[model samples]
Target: MYLQHPDDPEKGEVSESDSIIRTYQTYNKPYELQPEDIISLRIASLTPAEFDFVKQYEEQLGIIRKLNQYNQGTQDGGNQNNMRMQGMGAVGEEGSGLMPIMLDRQQTGFTIDRKGNLELPEIGEVQLSGLSIREAEELIKSKLINYFETPVVRIQLLSFHFTVLGEVNNEGRYTSFDPETNVIDAITLAENLTDFADRSRLKVVRFSGSEAQVYYVNTLREDLVSQKGFYLQPNDLIVVPALRARQSRRYLLPATTNIIGVTASALSLILIILNQTQ
Candidate 1:
């Protein structure tokens, strides 16, 4: 996240740590936070429960990597490897543009069509409206197998993503195939919250078929990953509320009220004195 140092009058770009140090210096009026001051920021400091949730995705990612390597002809020499190669060759002439089926990319909230089908070049209209990218690939490949021997189809989610807004540095939409991304990822993609962001008042808006649901997430105390309630779905919208300055408003309110009251009292006194004199 980008931030400005309180010491630096120019307000140039600075890291989150630097900004926090400057804030400490400004408030405490003690030792100025220097670059040499020791500091560290890493996920290693997270609680065990938090680490478990984060590592769950890591293990899943590893398994997905293995599966991809196996599917992409990366196995070492063995019976299983040879059989896989033979099966691939059984499809048709190798690299004839017939074996590899390329599917059209889809964006977030993209529906197949009115008929709930996708039109491929040779295959024509095939059902794939509500299926995910992986599911769509499997269905397409299964159908192609009837015509070809072993069809290898490549599929990708082109527009599977949502937008994050409000008190964030970079507010925009980001794409991802993994459906596990939660509110934290959404905020992280927006470069985290600004210094004046209210962590306790973050809001998430999700649009369904004919309605939208709104949720409030407290970033300071909430468990982002565990709370599936705040997890982002396709086309979800996140908004971080700006921090309301307590002193500025609270102090000004009573002072302004007193001033107005005093002014009215003075005006009444002046009117009374003028009437008596007349």
Candidate 2:
């Protein structure tokens, strides 16, 4: 558990110049591409001779943008309907009815092969296993240098998703395009933490190569913002465990009450039989 620093009311009137504050540096590292990661690749020409190719690429991008807009509209309508159902007490679970809507609105992107390679138009099978987005763009640019004069390459990770499980209102996988997404953002996507959530024992699980690393985060503290695990990566898993009190109330108390009720009923029946014999 994490505690906040106590604020003194009597000593609060300090000048800004006299106050001392400590700051911690946060890691803003770029994400490396991995197997099964979906990405969008675009190669633009700097010269006029290849303008036709650029036009074709732009048209394709326009079509994708339109499709994404339509999907977003559909998702919004679904969310509104779900909310209405919830308010009417028709929906039982928090995220139960939204999965199909989310799946239907998913955007298709190019998936990286198991061998750590990506096959692109004109440039086939480029090894992008351990490279960052910028490095991969440079590699693609170099490959197209002989064919075109100074090809401008742009690569964006399209499938940026993370999972939130346990004590959240909406526990499921969420996708976003923001590179600077943090734990708070991920939780917000899952409709924030539930009332029974244990904030002090939140867990973030990340996988690197063949090993998985788990990091404990204390959401109640201010120092969590400076922690490296504060910012979430693609495919990160956030687990918010339920509080002990909630578990006892939801499961233990009911079982104990049922046993007591049965015992009382049995004792009453035996007393009734004794009275009849008398």
Candidate 3:
């Protein structure tokens, strides 16, 4: 599992990159629901047409996503993981002839207000703040039990997003369906860093209560895996500045190419004139 440098067969370095590793201080803690968070909640019932919007929403969202991919003309994106932490497994008609239900629709989700409560269309207002995804699903399923016999509930945090800016092919906000995202994952979602990106200056900003904490990382260093900045928190902002010294090269590259082209053209013209005069 190693690749030797082509010019020097004895040299091997990048082969170590075969595996990516990262560690987080909050690795064990699941992301808790916060005010202004958006969640998609769906339930399964015995009634055939019951809670059909969940399935329809998923279908519509798929269409819109496909159209977006087509319009953007780029296929590079992080895989949107389906986080089924609990409740309902598959679409089966085991004995009741009912399909497992889910919450999704044209990407529309219930937003938790400033009070940390979601005013769901079906279940009314429910306080979901400070609750993890698993906890929220459990609570919602418990409530659905009063309505449907053998009810199944599914939820997705549609508002889980992060922003990647500077020194990347695609610089913008990206939705993360999975909460366990790391530095490499975020950069990949941004289509990886550009050639001018400074690997030693990867800056990550995390907003804590009333304050912002910044972490710096050097991707070229092997110790980065153990660094606190290795793992990206929800809503983290990643800014990768261009190589400090080589940044000028980004603009100089075109000018250098033009100079070379002009010099080559002049040389060709001089050779032609000499041949004609001789």
Give lDDT tens digits, candidate 1, residues 81-101.
222332334445574322221
TM-score of 2: 0.70
Which should have the higher TM-score, number 2 or number 3?
A: 2
TM-score of each model, in listed order: 0.47, 0.70, 0.59
Query: Which candidate achieves the best lDDT against the true structure?
Result: 2
lDDT of 3 by residue, 206-273 (tens): 88779999999778765566678777767889999998656667678878999999999999999999
RMSD of 1: 22.0
Show model 3 residue runs off by greater than 4 Å: 1-28, 45-48, 51-107, 221-226, 247-278
Report how far residue 47 has shifted in candidate 2, in Å.
Answer: 3.9
What C-alpha lDDT values do all the predictions have?
0.55, 0.75, 0.71
lDDT of 2 by residue, 1-278 (tens): 23344452346685567565656677768888888887776666856654545345545655675456546656665445212222222456455443232222223456689988987555568999799999998998898887677789888887788899999999898888877898888878998888899988899998777888998888887677777778888989999999999999999999999999999999999999999999
Number of the predicted model whose TM-score against the real structure is largest: 2
lDDT of 2: 0.75
TM-score of 3: 0.59
Arranged by TM-score, best first: 2, 3, 1
